[model samples]
Target chain A: MERPTLDQIWAWLDQIPDPEIPVISLVDLGVIRDALWKGDTLHLKVTPTYSGCPATAVINLDIQQHLRANGIDKLVLERQLSPAWTTDWISEKGRRNLQKFGIAPPPKDGEHGSYGALLGRVVECPRCGSKTTERISQFGSTPCKASYRCTECLEPFDYFKCI
Target chain B: MADKALFEFLTRIGDTTLVLGHRVSEWCGHAPALEEDIALANTALDLIGHTRMWLSRAGEVEGKGRTEDDLAFLREAHEFRNYLLVERPNEDFAVTITRQFLFDAWHRLMLISLQESSDQRVSEIAEKASKEVAYHVERSTDLVVRLGDGTEESHRRMQHAVDILWPYTGELFTDDETDRELSDRGIIPLPSSLEGEWKTHVDGVLSAATLVRPEREYAHKGGKAGVHTEHLGFLLAEMQVTHRAHPGATW
Candidate 1:
């Protein structure tokens, strides 16, 4: 068997969708920090979106299984917590997918300034793109999201909260 | 020199969050509203997530060939070290809100202090946990104010909750030899140092909520030293039951 290059491994990882948000690949979601070759074994650094995100374990398993299925059997997945995962890491491609899937992608960090960032207070409706939205709760169905309601559309949606 | 103290200190926080996380999890389906149910569960997951990191670190420090699971599931109640304040039951929504508000205040302060820890592991975990806890404090503080200043019934319940829990809060600020050594090494903050800020924060919240601060001087102590109230045993029973029953079971 031939050893896959790091770029090749990343391409494989990019095929793996986030288990919870199946629209975006793990690479675009930014949880897959880095993939490297250490001897015959492949070592990858993965950071969780939320420290307590239940999907973290599934994501790890999916990465391992997907890589193994691709003929790369030796794998090591490391959990990286420092410089924690922020919605800032979600790629432009991933953000579009989230919006297309009826979830408001988080407002970019400096877009809101420190005041809005501190409160995470501004959000546009993912459904109607209306600026008038009120937070339903700081929590949603998942750890990485917050529940919100669009005043214009009257439709409730999830916001991928910025860390 | 501080390895033993560090291990004990890690267990103290690990178990505190674990017990509190379990107690919060009990509100999963039973919260007063659907949004609250989701919110409570989310908070529980975050706390438990922090618990995994803390306990795993504790196991590493102890070097006893124990993993986080071993430390969390195998320990008897007597072997556990957590705060007595965390073990208090969630009597009702008001009580739960009150307890979370109190703990989150101290937790926030402690984490902020710890983000500066000289230990790389400690500081890194603290840096990550600090962000999540920032949200916890915001949510808990908002609720404490709302419930405290709400209608008579809610106000009464919130007041009762605060008064009952006030005594246990004292234990969090009392420092001992472990705290002394750790602070000397710049690994962790002296618990007492956090009290001033905790009080100022809690006071502002209580004021906004229209709740009076308790004047009680007698404080319940000893959860740090592994002395616990009766509530912890039941929590551990339910928490550890699955692990004990299946022993090394994995999905």
Candidate 2:
């Protein structure tokens, strides 16, 4: 029996959906930073979107369980803190998935250049594509999101907040 | 002695973040709005997560067996090294935002300078924390401007909160013997050095918000020396009660 390749493990991880936002996989979310095999043990580097995200534990467990099911017994999951995770790390596919799932993705130019830039973000409404959206709150249903309301559609939605 | 100073300095960072984190946690479901509710909770978690990192480093520097939990829950109020600003009660929504804004402003500058510390671990933690603090500063600054300039009632309340919290802000820049010692070794930046930039940032935001800077002569002090406000005891009691009641238990 041949050992599973790194690609095979990543493929399996691609199937693991985020617990909160089920439409996106962990890979798409950019939480799974790196993965490789060393000797008989598989090593993975994971970065949490928010340092205190409660979902991280669940996500870690899910990753472990998924990889474990693939017959890899020895696993090392390391939490990398430096070069912290950001909303910009969210993949293009992830942004599309977030939009399709009715949550607005962050701006393509998510650079928090200045205070004006942060407050001046014009996130299009996921449902109506309206530019006349107002932020209801800097926080949202989850730590990683912000609550915004579309003036045109009169709809409220979550925005994947820029870190 | 350098190791001891490093340990002390790290605890100061850890304790202040931990206490403020706990204070913010008290606002979990009680924030004025659902979005603020989530934001405040997220901020609390971020601060607490930072507490774990700094305290764990402190423990390592101290060469002691005490874990982060041991330092956090087990310490008495007098043993705690958090700023009086952080331990003060969250009087209201305005006051909470005011406290956060003031602290975040100084914290951002402090972390930015610490990123250049000769101590690699300290520098790394500072680098990571600087990113989070940037967002925190932005969040508080935006809220401060909104509330301070929003309406007659909001402006009045925000002004009151800023005045009430002003006395505590002075302690953030006052360095002590340990800080001075650390500065000599390039282990930590001088606290006073960051004050100029901190004041500029605060002034900019307050000007934007149409709020006045308080000129009260009384600046609360001694949190660095383990002297805290009367409120810390109660805050610690509530924070530690769960851990104390059920020692060695895990979820």
Candidate 3:
């Protein structure tokens, strides 16, 4: 069998969806920092969305299993935590996918702000694209999200919180 | 260059987060609302993760065989170097928020300065922690305002919590010889120097919340010197029991 290219491995990884938000792939989430093949071994770098995200372990396991099934057995997964992960790293496609999946995408370049920004910022409802939404809580079903209610749609949704 | 000072500094930061994180974790499943339950638990998890990072690095620097778990679970209350403010009992929802708000504000300021430390590892950790602490500050500030300025009953409870927690805040900025040594080397900022910014930030939030700053008096001190309130022992007892009972047991 011809050796699979680095691009091919990434393609395989793209098939593995995030356990929490199954509609989006790990690549879309921007968690997969890098993937490189070093001779016979493949080295992968991953950054979690949050320092304490419980889903990190599950995501690591899933990556290993998915890549191993593709016959690339020698793998090294390094968790790079420096510079920290930010919501701005979420791929454009990931944001769109998250919105389509009923989770509001965080604002781009919303990297630095004060408490006032959190209170005053507006987030459109993912379900209806209605600009009328209010945050119910700064927390949601996951660590990286906030709970918001769409006044127009009368539906509750998660807003991928800006970190 | 004294390694002891460095070790002590690392432990001071680590133990504060570990102990306070344990306190925050206690609110899990018990918060007044579901959103608060998630928020507090999430904050606890973040603090615990930070504890592991700092302690693991401390162990490496100390050239000790102790792991993060060893430092966390094996140490007794007297050995801990956390601030007295953090080790206080979580008396109520109001108290928890009050404690968290004060600590979060100070923590963010400290971390912001630490990001410029001569120690690369410390700076990197501080950078990451500063971001998390910013969110924590925002969350706690919002809650403090909502509770303090909302109903009259809530305002009274919040005021009471502030009165109880305020005395302990002084110890957070009290620098000793170890802190002075580290400060001289630019490895860490003088804790007292950060007090000005802390006061400005904290006072603003309190004023906005329609809460009065408790009158300053004889402030509690000595947690950094391994002296803590009566609450630390019980907290450590409950926290350390499982690990002590089953040594080296892992699922």
Q: Which model scores highest in TM-score?
A: 1
- Comparing 1 with 2 on TM-score, the higher-scoring candidate is 1
Model 2 spans > 4 angstroms off: A110-116
DockQ head-to-head 2 vs 3, winner: 3
| TM-score, predicted candidate 3 vs. hidden true structure | 0.95
Looking at model 1, the pairs that clash are none
lDDT of 3 at B76: 89
Question: lDDT at B85 for candidate 1?
Answer: 94
- lDDT, model 3: 0.88
The candidate 1 chain A region of ten consecutive residues with least summed lDDT is A109-118
Candidate 3 residue A143 C-alpha distance from true site, Å = 0.7
Error of 1 at B2 (Å): 8.6
Give a tens-digit lDDT track for model 1, residues B30-78: 9999999999999999999999999999988998878888998999888
Off by over 4 Å in 1: A110-116
lDDT of 1 at B44: 96
The A-chain TM-scores of all the candidates are 0.93, 0.95, 0.93
Residue-level lDDT tens digits of model 3 in B35-135 = 89988998998898789779988888888688888999999888999999998888889999999999999998888899899998899788777777777
What number of clashing residue pairs does each candidate have, in the order they appear?
A: 0, 0, 0
Candidate 2 CAPRI level: medium
